[model samples]
Target: MTHTFEPEANKPGTQAGPIPEAAQETLPVVYQDEHLVVINKPTGLLVHRSPIDRHETRFAVQLLRDQLGQHVYPVHRLDKPTSGLLVFALNGDVARALSEKFNDKTIKKQYLALCRGYMPSQRLDYALSVKLDRIADKHKQQDKAAQPAITDFTTLATCELPYAVDRYPVSRYSLVLCEPHTGRKHQIRRHLKHAGHPIIGDAKHGKSVHNRFFANTFQADHLLLSAVGLDFSHPVTGTRLTLNCAAAPKFIQAIKRIDWQEPDWAVAIAPKWLAHG
Candidate 1:
């Protein structure tokens, strides 16, 4: 089964009038087919409704559903502040099959992150206890064993800025490509933090001095992490599918301001995708 990209407003016999509030927001469609749809979700948009952000009026799921005029099932999630490729299954059976692939660790995911300090290519094998939310995980167990988590990181580029954001007179940062073998919550951010190179805008696991410096200097306020690529087999057809997208505009602008070049692989994936606003 194959599906084409057609918004509800463009459908036949649909009356045109004042657009509803939900239709106002549009998520960038990266890839769409009969069984799955991928979107380059913007930063600060939740995958779905959550108690953590009760006041957020808009979400990716809601907006995408409104745009497609059909229900979408999210197979995975990105943090509220992280932006990049997000996949959604169009139906329940496909959603379950994709979820199983994710559960079995068959899906290969790649992320780009701007982190504090220069980092080297390395594989981090760590164990992380569940980071439960007070309101959201209220009914969950208080104590759980740490789960095994592993991530492979490669330093794409590095830059040193002449500013005293922290104790050092010159602050250094790196453009990192992260591939996590496990899907633990906040795994990349936490692993990078553990390695002493937390992502630039990670308020929970990063340094405030650098975060503030970037915000004040470059006006980049969102997390520097982006889910840039995903490689997996099509749930319906056994063919492999590779989906890639560029980071948010703010993220690209920050890289430009810092004079850091994106990796060749990232550029090759989407040449014009890095065109910053």
Candidate 2:
């Protein structure tokens, strides 16, 4: 789905406007120099075009391109529902170098997820090596086209909502730090689903009952995934670089619903080994 670049918003020097309220001046620049640019991307924005979403005209790539007035090539993708630090390169050399970090798994990316059930106080160990069952609809199961996926999650805090379920008491919530060893489409979502504790507001892998509760209670309409931190080598300087972005507003709002404080782990928790690598 290719959206035509429309230079509509006129700000004297720049073109493109009537910016959506969500797309207002919230693009926080974490790090930017001659080589690369990294910023906290807002959720509900597409990174690029795909066969699925054709009407999406305003994307991270296009928005940044217009903001910078030069081509900013995307180095990685954050699912439309996921928001956090996203990297882009100003030139092909930087793009290639940064791509290598991701391809070799040298870059460490960490996310904060709010799950439906109580995540074990102890570290949750699980491997999601499930076959990719690509079906036309999510309700039906297709043949297993397996892929190796692994996720490590640790519970930061847990709480019970005031609302009640059918027979059970109030529902539970867990704030978890997720480290994805592999970047598959919806890997974290699926892994948490396989673990029997899907992330809240996950339309594809989560339960509708919990989603409705979050929306009605917390006003959350998107998935609860935030790319809280990332570490990689500077493409231009070849020096170790680390950047972190705060959890999205919706994430903060949801946490308020459970009456919990953001823990120290909510800060960047990538492995120390990546700094040496």
Candidate 3:
């Protein structure tokens, strides 16, 4: 069954009218089956409720559950500001199985990110300390050491704008395709930042000047990172499934404004696993 939901307004914390064109549209369902369903979650929508974003009314889980008229179990999540493919299991058993696949590194995830500097193709083998939330992980141990985090990335496209968003006369950027071998929280963003090519629109780790430039120039105000693809064996069917979707409209518009050609993997669905193979 096809499902849709009205996205949250562009301006956060307000639910009234005058929603942006993208916000007014329905949530795009990428793939679905008897055991599972996946949706192209728009930027700004929470995967579920949390104390961190207590004021937000709209959530992907609630919307998807209401739209599908069944309880859906979220196997994984995307950051609230990150947009694209999200998976949900129809039953608890499948959820556990899929969760195990993610825990065991059996499932592959591909992400597209627009970063501030031109990044080269490389593998980042860095470790990241656990980022605990004040409200959520307050009771947990705080002195845990950094865990291993690795990401394989390629610079798919690059462009230089004439405007000096930073100290340089010309602002440089790259479109990156990243496959994370480990699911560390914010692994791709942190790894890219460590490489000195932080993804645009990353508030915590990116340069504010370049972020403001994109917001004013292209009207793209959200994070430029998106989970574009997920490849895994279906929990019940035991068949390989490669699910893909394009980035959010604002993200694509920013890429076009920079005159970078969108790679086929960015917009087209792949029939087989193509990253980190």
Candidate 4:
């Protein structure tokens, strides 16, 4: 959670995490319209810049701004290390509308994650409030308990790596679908860790042994979680709007290496983090 990075006066982007000099156009636009825009954000690129990443220029907000040639506002943010669906508002009116929905827990979000160890067979509905690890706060801002965060998770598939993973015999991992009822900084990552199934490739809370294995074998270095789906009532149209995005290529590739299968929703109703904030 702690980084030794120092602030740079010349380059704001560089003070944050690694930022590409040029804006990334490769982010896929999953859904777009006059009021809202959705994109499949890439891993390793920040949604916005922080003090530590001040020198970096590559960010979701900036890229979308340049691509549209107008100002767009972010309704919510995803972790820089996580890739998946992201939503934006085209104007302040839309921003306020969407923001209200999110604050009221009317917006529904789903994420895909690969985590170490086995998850409970039953569905999980938990509330979490994270106290930001001061170490992650490069700006040295006021710190307090994060907003009340709630996340629900269901295990889709569980697989054990065939190869030996250090001292553990064939590390067990799960493909879980997460639905977050509340948005908090690093909510998914912190909640998964709290469940004792820290996400794979999450250097912050994940085991170093597992991270080394993935890095050595797959050359993957970011967290194995993605926000794949979101649903909410359109602020302007007053109609139901649902959006879904696919897992990033690297995450898909990693999951493909393991034996996996999807579960049938034959019955049951659906129910519904971090030190390095």
The numbered model that scores best in TM-score is: 1
Which ranges of candidate 3 are over 4 A from the true structure? Answer: 1-26, 261-277
Over all chains combined, what TM-score does candidate 4 have? 0.80
- Candidate 1 lands at a TM-score of 0.90
Candidate 2 local lDDT, 210-258, one digit each (tens): 8888888788878988887786667667677767666667766666556
Global lDDT of each candidate: 0.84, 0.71, 0.81, 0.72
Backbone Cα, N, C clashes tallied per candidate = 0, 5, 0, 17
lDDT at 30, model 3: 69
Q: Which sections of candidate 2 miss by over 4 Å?
A: 1-26, 121-145, 261-277
**Candidate that scores best on lDDT:** 1
Give per-residue CA lDDT, model 1, range 59-90, as digits (tens).
98888887787889999999999998888999
Q: In candidate 4, what are the lDDT values of residues 60-132, reduced to their tens digit?
A: 8888776665688998888888887788999999999998998899988888888888886444455555455
Taking all chains together, each candidate's TM-score versus the true structure is: 0.90, 0.79, 0.86, 0.80
With candidate 3 superimposed using the best TM-score fit, by how many Å does residue 183's alpha carbon deviate from the native? 0.5
* Shift in Å, residue 90, candidate 4: 0.7
Query: Positional deviation of 57 in candidate 3, in angstroms?
Result: 0.5
Off by over 4 Å in 4: 1-26, 121-129, 133-147, 261-277
Report how far off residue 145 is in candidate 1 (Å).
0.2
Q: Would you give me the overall lDDT of model 3?
A: 0.81
Candidate 3 per-residue lDDT, tens place, 1-277, comes to: 2132223332222345564543344466767788998888889999999999889988888777756667899998899999988999999999999999999999888998989878999999999999999998899999999999999998888887888777789888898889999999889999999999998999998989988888889998989998888888889988888777777778877765566544453443232212211
Query: What's the best-to-worst order under lDDT?
Result: 1, 3, 4, 2
